[model samples]
Target chain A: MKLNLRVWRQQNTDAEGAMATYEVDGISPDMSFLEMLDTLNEDLILRGEEPVAFDHDCREGICGACSLVINGDAHGPERTTTCQLHMRSFRDGDTIDVEPWRASAFPVVKDLVVDRSAFDRIIQAGGYISAPTGSAPEAHATPVPKPDADSAFEHAECIGCGACVAACPNGSAMLFTSAKVNHLNVLPQGAPERETRVLDMVAAMDDEGFGGCTLTGECATACPKGIPLPSIAAMNREWLRATRKARR
Target chain B: MTLGPSVGLMALATRTERRTEPQPSMTRIFWRSTVGKKTVMALSGLIMLGYLVAHVMGNLKIFFGPGEFNAYGHWLRTMGAPVLHHSWALWIVRVGLLAAVIGHAVSAYQLSRRDIKARPTAYVHKRPRASYATRTMRWGGIILALFIVWHILDLTTGTVHVGGFEEGRPYQNVVDTFSTWYGNVIYIVAMLAVGLHVRHGFWSAAQTLGAGNARRDRALKAMANGLALVLTAGFVSVPVAVMTGVVS
Candidate 1:
């Protein structure tokens, strides 16, 4: 298969960027999206051109590093992460426009590489088990309900890819923040820091220059992990309840 | 420091150009940018909702006595446009309210357009048997707008021509309007519109603000639905009581 690619190119954080077009021929249909990019980069290097700078580590979609906005949809119009996307999704002579996440909160660090450190900051704000980690307690000692455990695990699936942040009109990472907050906050071990977690995480999210949630469900739609929008609401309710409780 | 004729002419031209071109005010700023519009809508909508809650609470004072209720209205009018009994405070609030309504409507319009373009057949797979409130979001919003306009004309502007209002008995006019079966029915229908609008609006706004979570989406939805029910019930009860001769 042969394809046309219009990929964003920026030398550094301060460099102005443009979509630089390239052609990739003789690509196998079964090749992964990253593999295809790798082949293209091999060609670029052979021609003495600087290889396109992009983020990819595991190439299995678990690392949350192979991030790209393909053809205007985050993760290339597929329901999975970029690394999980395959060449079969495209056709011969297909033209794909690839760019990094375009958001003030997620600034481009280089070509197809964005600084998603804001998410890390937000997670650090409250997305943790504050209880001492040295204890050797049995896993079933707290006796978590099956439903709660299942729900926690579902929210725990979030990889903090910043896809929700990018897709949101408000540039809000609320879904991402909420998933992390709720994941731990719902558990017995997470109770001690629940109130503080809600407050600090919310404040951190605001400080990261992310917009407030409008509840359009766009984040959920764009999410490669299928993170639900409801998690944010739970965070909000928890925050409201915590504030009131604290006031009392 | 020699002021040549061309310099004077150039200065005059620059001054004229500056004067003719209106400076970009906050309203202009809001209208010119999407972020500005979102901010305006969020702030204004919250204010308007607060006002609505306050207004409902105050109007319920009619259950106390005609004098007490009328005094409350008189006090409100006194605060807005002052010495001539017109309170500037009221004008500020009125302007704020107008801004909220206009901003909400305008932003909603743009969002609705984008939504359409984003998913040309979004509701194609939507079940036809979905709740009336869920399916009628657009219709409910329109109906609520019409209801608001009618309410302003009937009570505030005195243009609806209810009998006792023109005779200097605004409280009695309200009672009379609610006492009639048809008027009571219209009021109930309008409240239903408010209920439907709020049902979707609350969560939708939250999403727009980026407050969603996968875990809490359903819970927030249930809570929003409950809020809508309570609000509708509160507003509907007043007219229902009057029609049933419970208030008269």
Candidate 2:
């Protein structure tokens, strides 16, 4: 099968980008979307032209490194991660437009890759427990309620892929920050830093120039990890409690 | 391994610099983030929804005749008895409702602006995964705003009332407002918008205020739909009754 791809191309962060058309034929129905891109790059390399650059580390969807907005969605035609999306979803002669995450914080690095270090900075602000890094404590040392542990683990599924940022019309990072905040704050071990975690991380999020959440919910839909929208509300609860506690 | 005197001086300097960094109040910090704004939107929406529920219940009193509806209107003013002046309780409710409206509008406007700022560039091929109600929020809000102004003019202030506008006769004024075709049109259209807004807003408010989860997702959705349907039926019932000569 053959597909027409309009891929965004940029030489560097400082360079202006545009959509470059590529016609790739003989694509297998079983091939992943990224594999299809690899085939395109291989053809470009053989032709002595600059290959299209895109980010991919795990190719298994666990590593959130593979980022692309396919046909206007954060991942591609499917809600799954870019790497996990199979070529069979599209028909022969289909036109697929691929582009980097369009956000002020995540600037285009080369082609499909956008710098996602802003997320790292937010995590650095809090997103952790400050217990000494030594021999790990026994899992059962802290008796966490099953419900809280389950909720925490669910939020912990977030891969920090910036899909929430990319999917949001406002490019808001609330869902990402909320997931990180709730993942720790819901657990017994995270109680000590709960109040400060929401504060510092939220501060970091704003400092990074992300957009505000309007409850449009495109982020949750686009999230590969299926992070629920309630995580953000949980973060809101945390922030309110933290604010009131700080006031006292 | 260490430059003792210089390091000591540097530590002191760092401490001084840290101290000089401004410590923003928790309220300021909370209101600055998208999560905070979402919380405000949710809380305010809940407040308005509560008011609508109560208002619709009061409207149902019209089914009991003019004496009952008039008495109900009078009762609203004397809510606090001799302990508090007449209409004082009503004024308090009014003030609160006004604040909620202002909070909802201001947060929505600000967040919309921020959302746009987050994405300087839009996707070349855009496809949204959000619900229809969520997509129509901005226009729905505007329609509701315009409706409120016309509603107040037609009924509350009677500035644009078609028939004889009688003071203190809440039943007659309501009937008079509905008697006109324009009144019914505006009121019915507004109610439809309200239904859509509540259908989306109620569920969203639950998520924003930390009252939602995967287990309760369906229940929350049901409740939202129920509320929207009930409100629309409840509010629209009066106008329909007037048109059918059941109330008038």
Residue A166, model 1, lDDT: 61
Cα error, residue B125 of model 1, in Å, equals: 26
By TM-score, who's the top model here?
Answer: 2
Model 2 pairs whose backbones collide: A170-B115
Candidate 1 residue lDDT tens string, B172-224: 77887886667777788988888787777766655434464555567768977
Model 2 regions more than 4 Å off = A11-16, A137-149, B1-22
lDDT of 1 by residue, A25-95 (tens): 98998898988999999999999999998888887777787788788777877899988998999999998
What TM-score does candidate 1 get on C-alpha atoms? 0.61
Candidate 1's docking class is incorrect
**Candidate 2's TM-score:** 0.91
Q: Can you tell me the DockQ of model 2? A: 0.55
Which candidate wins on lDDT? 2
- lDDT, model 1, position A31: 90
> How well does each candidate superpose onto the true structure, as a TM-score?
0.61, 0.91
